[model samples]
Target: MEASFTKVKGGALVLKGEKKKKHKKTKKRDRSGERDGEGGKKLKKNLEHEDMNKHGGWWQTTNLAHIVGPVALQFYNGAYMKALDNGKFVLGAPHDEGQGPEPEEILMAMKVGDGKFSLKSGFDKYLRLDKAARMVGVSDAVGAMEMFDPVWEDGKMAVLGPNGRFMSVDDEDFVVFDQDKVGPAQIIRIRSNREREDMKKTEIPEELRGNLYQVETKFVKKFQKFQDHKLRLNPNGVAELVEAKRGGNLHETLLDRREKMKSDRMCK
Candidate 1:
């Protein structure tokens, strides 16, 4: 064996050692493409939550302020159709088994948002004198106005009728002593604008179903916070929409949701 002496230039060591251990690397997940199969379902769920919070749908956007304006307008639409066709909100929500917003009601809501007419902040609480002045902008004034109800009593303001009745400054609507009877009786008698009976496939589409549910859920939750606020407004919306309607009881009042869910396809 020949032994060779190594000559080092500039004191640098060069050595060949044992092999190094290979470490495993974890993979990074791409959530966007991951939402397929079971992953897809989870992605859908997350997306639904995001959309409901920011972009609420039409009927949902129809808050109390919006409803009163649209209601007043629908009354006009009904009166117009009634004149042109017979008398009632044109394209009224169908009467009978289906208890829900009608196409005409939807149309009226659209029309109101279309800039055809606008309301002041306190429009709902407007007295006969004020509402009368604003009546010119409304299409039909005939059945638009009426005097019905229980007067609202406040130390500052007092009204008397079934507390409140739909009325016009220059007109009068028939009064029903029993509140329970009138809603069902009249609600069932109206006609809807759309002939489409399948509410699930009718008003809202399937893809939007999840988002719609989110809107209602959030709104209801938010509305609950207004308990003390309700006692303040003319008739607290918090009271009527939230307090007045409770679990199970609220479900009983609305039409069979499962049945309705099967047909409604609308979402504005």
Candidate 2:
């Protein structure tokens, strides 16, 4: 018989030209409970998978402090550090300019210390500094050579490899950590899935929702009742309300203040 090869679903090559014997069909077993349990497990697995991929887009990190989680290091020329299937890294352009990095360019960054981190590539290899001072993604685990320190200065970020040198791209577009000082080539933008710091500042708490005096005034307007739609604020400073809030009696304090103003309908 002639032998042939066939490619399987998972990129595996298998030998063909074999005749297999069929087995006799037996009575089906009642495995409904087992099937339901397996279905539930698959649903849970799918939910977790969705959650992991939810935070996919990228935002630039202003400082080294925000360089954790899934990240991509882009050089000044708009090229991202992409890992190849051969366990090598190169500067590759993104499919979309501002959308985000491709899977091969995204790295899972884990903070190991105050300023140290370990980056894992899509190939399931940890990026490390080889003995030749070249950046490679061949390590299966995070070792000393896998630890990297991020440096932020003058609004630019640079990475320090395990060899205590700054990482820069060479003329061949290969990553090397041999530079003693940071320059245009060494200036990298570490982008991640984290929200921008300025955006986070826009989120205000419920109690502290508006301007200090405006919040109290709005409460007075809501509770105060008179023939005219007028707001009567106490001449007393907001120090009492601020203090009462710390003591968890802000509502009572506001009512008392409104009552003192003789404007609260409940006080009548």
Please, what are the lDDT tens digits per residue for candidate 1 over residues 5-77? 1233475455688565444431223343454467877776566445333322112222222223332222222
Which candidate has the highest TM-score of all? 2
Q: Candidate 2: misplaced stretches above 4 Å?
A: 1-57, 94-97, 196-198, 201-268
Model 2, 1-268: lDDT tens digits are 0011122346645469766544453223336667878999998656634533542456666655676778988888777898878877888864443356778888988888666889998888899877768789988887788998877654557788878788888777778898877777888888787665544556554654676488788787776677776767888888987898789887788878878788445466
| True-structure RMSD, every candidate | 32.3, 20.0
Estimate the TM-score of every prediction. 0.19, 0.55
Poorest lDDT segment (10 consecutive residues) of candidate 1? 151-160
The TM-score that candidate 2 achieves is 0.55
Clashing pairs in 2: none
TM-score of 1: 0.19
Residue 73 lDDT in candidate 2: 87
Error of 1 at 50 (Å): 11
lDDT of 1 at 256: 33
